[model samples]
Target chain A: MEAPDSNIAIAAAGWHFLCERAEILVLRVSREGAILHANRHAVELTGIPLEGEPLEHIFLGFADGPVGRRLLDRTGETHLANIRTANGLPETLYFTALPAGDEMVLFGQTDAQEQVRLRKEVLALNHEMGNLSRELTQKNAELAWLNAQKTQFLGMATHDLRKPAGLILSYAEMLEEEASGTLREDHLHLLDTIRASAERMKRVIEDFLDVAMIESGKLNLDMGVAAIEELVKSPLLLVSKSASRRGVVVTTDLAPAGQRLRVDGQKLEQVITNLLSNAVEQSPDGATVQVGSRRHGDGIRFFVTDAGKGFSEEVRGRLFTAFAGTGGQKRDGERSIGLGLAISRRIVEAHGGTMMAESPPGKGATVGFILPAQCLAPMRSDEQNGGVR
Target chain B: MSEQPGSDPRVDSVYDRYLASLLEGERTECTSVVEGLRAGEVPLRSLYVDLFQRALYQVGDLWEQNRVSVATEHLATAITERMVALVEPGVFGGEARRRVIVVACVADEYHQLGGRMAADLFELHGWRAYFLGANTPHSSLLDLIEKTKPDLVGLSLSIYFNLPSLLAALDAVRAAHPDLPIIVGGQAFRWGGEESLRRYEGVTLVKTVDDLERIATGHGSP
Candidate 1:
């Protein structure tokens, strides 16, 4: 245990520090493939006796080929190999060999267990995701099927309900006309209520069906060229009774008297009727509801202005939605399903037109829609510029 | 082949044709479009969403802008309603599950289309669906519920202003039959968002037909 020579001790200490601090498998082999030197880890990993065993003999258990020949023939070659431990357990290692004087020096690191586990997890996750995606596709198909069923059912309901409601209204009207003089005022009132109720029900059914049909892409329009007088007078005539009932004076102002529009007369009438009805309903007993139509730009602009409580900013924001007029009640105390304006806007837009509402608070409100000079496109072969040509 | 007006998927072209046909009062062409779509294997759901919904929305936009008249709008709607008959056979073919489902709009709520759609969805799920259209009297609705003893009840409120009526309907139903499952839908719920659904416990807010299917199937109840 006496202290070795200072030079020898220093060299020995340096060799030991280099081997342990490398943190990599370090091996030295002779030109003949004999094991010349090995670090602690290399020896432990390969389980070969240091400085004596032939590298070929040590790697015989796991190397794919003669490792000694492969390493000797190829300098600075990097490769992966399964090297066996003392107990014959296999651990994968990657290494690169470089010429070190007359011998070959190999440096490597064993593939860690964490990396292996992570790789397995990734593969499993990919498989799981595949299954999930397939399941999602299947669920979407099922959902689509259910949706189709729902649409169909709605169409059927609307159809079935509409006939009965229409029949009820028609019958009520017939009974009223047939028994007009014989019926008492109270009886007439009851009949009127029944008729009104049936009419309202019919409208509701029709609106429901219309929305369904439009949503299903089944709505169709008949386009025609009509005089501005007809467009203004038609809807006015429809709303005249309602206007007179509320004691609201009805007036009309049409500019450029003979100006005609190439439009859908029926749809345009509905739009006018809705605006006029709304206007008449909002007007006070003696207030006037004015209907006007004019040639504006390349289109006909029709408006119904009523001296009634104007729309608040909040109500205006949602005026075109399905539930229009829901934010506030009209002056007539009448409630709306809010579908009229929504439906009207869609009709005008379908005709390549626009609809709007304007009001100066306490100055009454003006509701109107515009019909372009021409429908943007001919909807069908038979409708190809039927009159516009 | 030239694309049919309502058959264009990119936009409202197909709906345009349909709307035009209705505007022209061409019943045969309108009916043909629906028949052709079905024969071509166009999914009914797509017809509803793409063709019908898009066209109707466009029609609404046009009418709102004063581009079309109320008469034309009504005609277009009327034609679309008739076209539903073309697909009626396929929609009402499911086996009856013996479960009654009642759908209705609240009192003073005149928008009954959403409820009608819900009722149909329930019926499609094999439930016996009863659609009490807009403004069902509270007493009658209660009586109908009692007589029918529906397994589920669906209520639709299209306008948010009708939330009070919805609440009233809910209270009436809940008082009459505690623990009954209720599902609510419509633009109102969507406009109000999730925070609105929180006002009532045990009432589920469903946005789409698919969501309604899930509820009817009992996979996603409130």
Candidate 2:
């Protein structure tokens, strides 16, 4: 054979350098699928020594018989293979194998068009997520502002209405005192009805004010030490009067009578009163309304049980939600304004306690609260003065 | 490269550590560096410009010099994108002002970090910034503008070759809403698109996070 010209030799060397330095994978493999050599780009991509290893080592899953023989059988045809890259991710590369005696030379490059499509898809999805996040933030801010406005409106309306309800109750009492002898029996009954309605209106207004204060995060607790029995029985006196009117019998099962808890006496009494009141209203005429307290799980549990139709699952789910009315008609046919349980739960939570409700179908409903052991700890000076504010 | 003005040497050390981790594609280390800076109370602007922007610019230069592969550069970008998101709760914690801004990369422009950072800066400064991510179609952008009625529009272009697309987006936005104020920025302007941008009456060019801050504070133009 004649010797090649000097120019052709230099050009051939330049082409070899270009091929070695290019951003493509170049591999020389034996017919048995063992890699004979790999160029610099291939070594960098795989981040491993390739020479003398099986060609299948670089592929994610190369079990199509012998990869080298398969590629050699269809020389000059492009094949797609997923190569394991240094990033622990698989990359799809288009490979073309050329036969060279007993060895197969494989050239591989990424499919740029497919990559561009995938990039677009990913970018679009990320953008959608970002937009949704921004919208959520905006909506949350708006909702917070609207809630503040609603609470403010409720506070003002209830405050303004409280004075009138009180005046009506006072005037009705004054009429009964000043004109009792001159007024007919039926006329005195009218005065009694007016007084009762005004009293009910005043209670509803007070409930609304409590809800407003709680919603606005101002439900401060006047923390003090008190016996659990005293906490349960003090509220029972007030609720018992109303229970007897509805032909319901109020009973107490007070255990741990001497057990003391650091709690707000007035607020806890109000919670007990609310729960007992709800039980009395929910029970059938002559049904038993049971109030009880016991030691429970490093805390104390107080419960009110009523012998009435239990709540359905749907109503039970939202039983403590403000304004979710008790899903049954009261024996007196009076509907609650529905803030009692909600306010009671918040008051318990402020004292580091939790509230609960249980209703078994056709049996009875039990509403209760558990004051955690933390409430038993002596109050810090700040908590004693400012309560749980 | 010039050091970022008012850059803290401590943050510079952090930047160096972060850059080294980023170049090596050590994602966990990079995340730790970013989280550490945030925990140490490094200002968000300084983190964005001095650490993230500075390191990414260096990576881009390294890619140009063939010292690092494209895959490594992309991995660095991906990691930095996640780090940016890690700081989002703080970014969006500011009390939102009544002003709103719409930000998007021009059509065919896939590099969205600059625009996203701009949107975050706007949010940090109390403006309600809505970011439409990479490769935003013109029609969808116009539809959003119509729906949101933003006080300002921002367009970002990262590749210099996409200058025409940026111009086309600006023209489409201007023709649709002539009086709407527009702010344009990104790596594409580093080469030379600012002169062409001056043709529009209400358009402004912002070069850095500080420049965007100036505009957000009603002090910057051109």
Candidate 3:
């Protein structure tokens, strides 16, 4: 005996359900355009007998676009077309035509208005996107212009401030010289204080200018090839007097000293001067500040180590920030301008180098920078001798 | 060294020594004089005005009186330029402000020492003062302004005849940057007087380095 829910029972039930409940117009037609049969819904909607009638009689026309051409050829594809209803009123329908056992089947629905509405919405969205793009471009231009203005104003103000400070320092120094023999010791002390204050102001002003230059992308590099030994020694000369005055001895350990690198000699000198001076300033009286350089794979690393109080982790976090000092007070007696490391880091990074600082509590601090060899490569044949390398 | 009634005797002697060296075309002597002045701790601005400016003025005056040839005058100016460079590093040290200012001589103006001094003053202050040299063409000057995008453009015209070029440059700069501040100076303004420059908008006349300092420190009224 066959089971009650067999495949044949399921197929008959599916066909019966489709013919009774499907909202689409389902019709059967011969290959020669003769109608064979029509579902109950199709006959009810068209109000015409479909069996044995020519398929063209009831449907006045079919669409001729891509979808309609598929339906005409009975290629089993869905199409959209305008068809005549029972009352001879025009209606848009999505029609699907298929072949079934020597007869053709067509399923159609009037859902063309929904597709039209969706297409209109997409066009509107595209228009809005175009407008938004134009607005973004306009805003970007305005931002660029405002940024330029800000840089200009700051540059002007910075330039105007320098000479007066220079002038004040000059007057103070002149007074110190002229009043030396005539003034009392206390009076001389006041003069010294004024000169020192003026000198400090000059230094701070210079630091501000440097920060501005680096930020504005206007720091010019005079790139040239020079002996690595000179690069290490020259900056020492600039700060030697200060170091000696502080009773801090600076020693150099330039391994592979004769190595040559392409760099901006003056800028590198400034970087070294800043770093060495800071090192010397941080070291205690009778302590040593060690500076060394060594070749690291396709690059050179330079370091400064001071035998003094190492900074706390808090200070190390902000060690390279402008105007940030060791817990707001320097360990050594030297006045901390605070911009040395900040400026030095910028200079190093601009030269395609990396700067870092490390201090393992009480072990003293080590600050170093690495200059990559790729950045130091000679740019052309002439630069090898003409300072272009 | 005879001490003047109201002047520092050391500054005067140093000034005299530099003047003699420049006139003699002794580059090494000029360098030595500057080094000595720096060693003695003489003021840089004082050296600029009392030595370089005064000496160049005397050279110009001598040329005017037919006591020195034009070539001698040119040599004196050139020596002063070199000396300015030589002494600059000693006088100016510190971090540079990121902002830029372009100092240019107005068209057809040959007196660049004044402008060079102004540039150095700016550099000393921490601004990257780009010295555009003497007699910069109007178009080139405008082009540089566009390229460098400086915060301020300083125009130096020492000859009265180049006043028109100065004005033209100011107009071009104004057109490009409607609100950019401009400072105008040079010997030309002394001859043309304030009346000629008073009509231009967004311009400041600086007669001394003090005025420049005031403007830089944001204390000047203009």
How well docked is model 1, in DockQ terms?
Answer: 0.01
- Tens digits of per-residue lDDT for model 1 on B1-222? 224444545324355667677677787888877787788777665565555545555665687799988656555654554464355445554443578888778887755545654565565566667677667778888888989898888888877888888888889988888888888887677557557557666788888767887877777875
Q: Which runs in model 3 stand beyond 4 Å of their true positions?
A: A1-151, A312-317, A323-327, A331-337, A375-389, B1-222
Off by over 4 Å in 1: A1-151, A180-185, A324-334, A373-389, B1-222
- Model 1 chain B lowest lDDT segment of ten: B2-11
Ranking by lDDT: 2, 3, 1
> How close to the true structure is residue B16 of candidate 1, measured as C-alpha lDDT?
62
Q: What docking tier does model 2 reach?
A: acceptable
Q: List the TM values for chain B, per candidate.
A: 0.76, 0.94, 0.87
Candidate 1 per-residue lDDT, tens place, A214-271, comes to 6566768887867667776777888888878878898989766656566788878888
Expressed as tens digits, the lDDT of each residue in A111-180 for candidate 3 is 7578567654544353234324323443454466576566667567767888998999999899888879
lDDT of 2 by residue, B42-109 (tens): 88888887888888889989998999987787778877877787767667653436989999998988
> For each candidate, what TM-score against the reference?
0.40, 0.77, 0.40
Taking the tens digit of each residue's C-alpha lDDT, what string does model 2 give over A156-244?
99999999999999999999999899999999999999998999899989998998999999988788888777788778888878878
Worst 10 residues of 2 chain A by lDDT: A375-384
Model number with the top TM-score: 2
